[model samples]
Target: MLLELQQIIVHPGQQMLLKDISWQQLENILEEMGERRAARISYSNGWLEIMVPLAEHEKDKEIVGDLVKILLAILDVDFEPFGSTTLKNERMRQAVEPDTSFYIQNQGAVIGKNRIDLNIDPPPDLAIEIDITSRTRFDNYAILGIPELWRYQKQGLEIFLLQDGQYVKSPFSPNFPNIPIVELVNEYVPQCLTIGRSQAMRNFRSWMQENLQ
Candidate 1:
């Protein structure tokens, strides 16, 4: 049975904490929460947390996600985006749904697979988390061994890379090692909100073609 379930209201949304939950229980919760895109659920070491993402949180998520995709396309890189897909490792007792995830170098590994088993399959190459309402637990992702993580909070983007079994603050993304990760996100994300996504993407593509050449 689920234990120590409590709800905390945070002005715009709610977060529920459940303690002493088993890995099986966390899997059950995910099954029950299927297709509920707004819910952010994380479980680690017998603890479970559920959060309803705030509107502003989603706005930043979209902006960042779009910017990343634009970068991949303009650079002619192969990638598969899995937006907010639940990633779980039963043996590790850890699970999380990133705001946006991508299979970059390992895209072919997950192709045509209906279900991913972390035991064998490689985890997403990059994961994006937007922290506006509630902060994500970086420790959990570290345990999951996701190669790179991008976190957007307080109008600033932070990049972290997995190194020596831990996440270290990174100045450049492993995905785009030569480019400026935080600067690109900061400049284009807000511009998308101002000029509309379509126009912003078009302009960005044109600029990238010229600059990247």
Candidate 2:
């Protein structure tokens, strides 16, 4: 078999950008790339960004994702977690694979489903990105109309809520309006690095319990 020129190598903590990529071309690339790939993607208009996450990026993604899950579980909210699932809309000319995503308010919409078609199905309620590599781009998520987005970078978290068609930085997540999510990220995520993940999670749960009570 001959080698395909389509192969490209993206290093961790780095990103590659391509221009004038058509929607059909993007679809073909996605199909060829398969779903289990480690690289995350963000496409808007005719621009595509391919980002390869570093190991630290994955660690941060997992920890932040765990934090979100814990928050939902403690709040007794029904949610479905979609980790790095490709979300594409041909009409909108946008495709995004977030580090982690959740269907909270729209959890029932995707219950017991293996595949998600963004054209027919509702988008995830909240999407989280761990930008340890600082290579994440938000245009696609905003265009895809994800209601809430949490961006964690360098041990800090920022919540962006979709009010109209754009994302607005907000201190509180609509899903967890009463909790101090930013502070939670600043506090426990670092604790995870120091005390280890399991202990950090335990402390976070206890802290939430004390605060929420």
Candidate 3:
């Protein structure tokens, strides 16, 4: 504990890993950091990583999240969005704060609840992470039993479905099997920068309506 938590500085697009951090220490650190901070964290066993996302990272996350909301609305699917909520399990000694998470099939389970306890409540049906700043740890999500995860990096979007206790890369998301999400995001997300977020979303909506049928 020589290096106090306040002394640790994680620059944008950079991350720091601390070793041998106990579960209680992690809890204390999380409490100290507070809920509104910009940094995100992941813990596995005794290892903890604190990451500060870059500006592009935030932009990417927003655009993709908007697109997801549009999809859910059009499909008339009931869902609840949890943005960067802390999901942790003390028994598993694993924790992650995703860019966004959604309760789709299990939406009713978390309604009106202020907190989500993985020990009792079901894991999010879909988890989204923008990997521009730091790579996601699949082990944490897999161990948590999240059914699906979307990872968007510089290359493009990737959809992974939990199958047989592991994430298998797939071209389509289980929730939107008829649509090609990877292609849609890659083509539309950049439009947020060029034409503005609102216009980009409108265009995406028009495209969805015209093409979905």
Angstrom error at residue 151, model 2:
0.9
Q: Candidate 2, residues 153-188: lDDT per residue as tens digits?
A: 884999998877888899897788877889988999
lDDT of 3 by residue, 1-213 (tens): 387788878899999999999999999999999989999999999999999999999889988998999999988889999888988888889899999999999999999976677878899999999998799889999999999999999889999999999999998888988898898999899888899888989999999888874
What are the TM-scores, per candidate, against the unseen true structure? 0.91, 0.92, 0.96
- Model 2, residue 33: distance off in Å is 1.6
* Model 1 lDDT, full chain set: 0.83
Better of 1 and 2 by lDDT: 2
For candidate 2, list the clashing residue pairs, or say none: none
> What overall lDDT goes with each candidate model?
0.83, 0.85, 0.91
Per-residue C-alpha lDDT of model 1 across residues 42-104, encoded as one tens digit per residue: 888998988888898888898789888888998999988888888888889888889999999
**With candidate 2 superimposed using the best TM-score fit, by how many Å does residue 131's alpha carbon deviate from the native?**
1.7
**Regions of candidate 3 where Cα sits further than 4 Å from its true position:** none
Candidates 1 and 2, the one with greater TM-score: 2
Kindly indicate the candidate among 2 and 3 with the higher lDDT. Answer: 3
Error of 2 at 52 (Å): 0.5
Name model 2 segments beyond 4 Å from true. 1-6
In Å, residue 155's CA in model 2 sits off its true spot by: 5.2
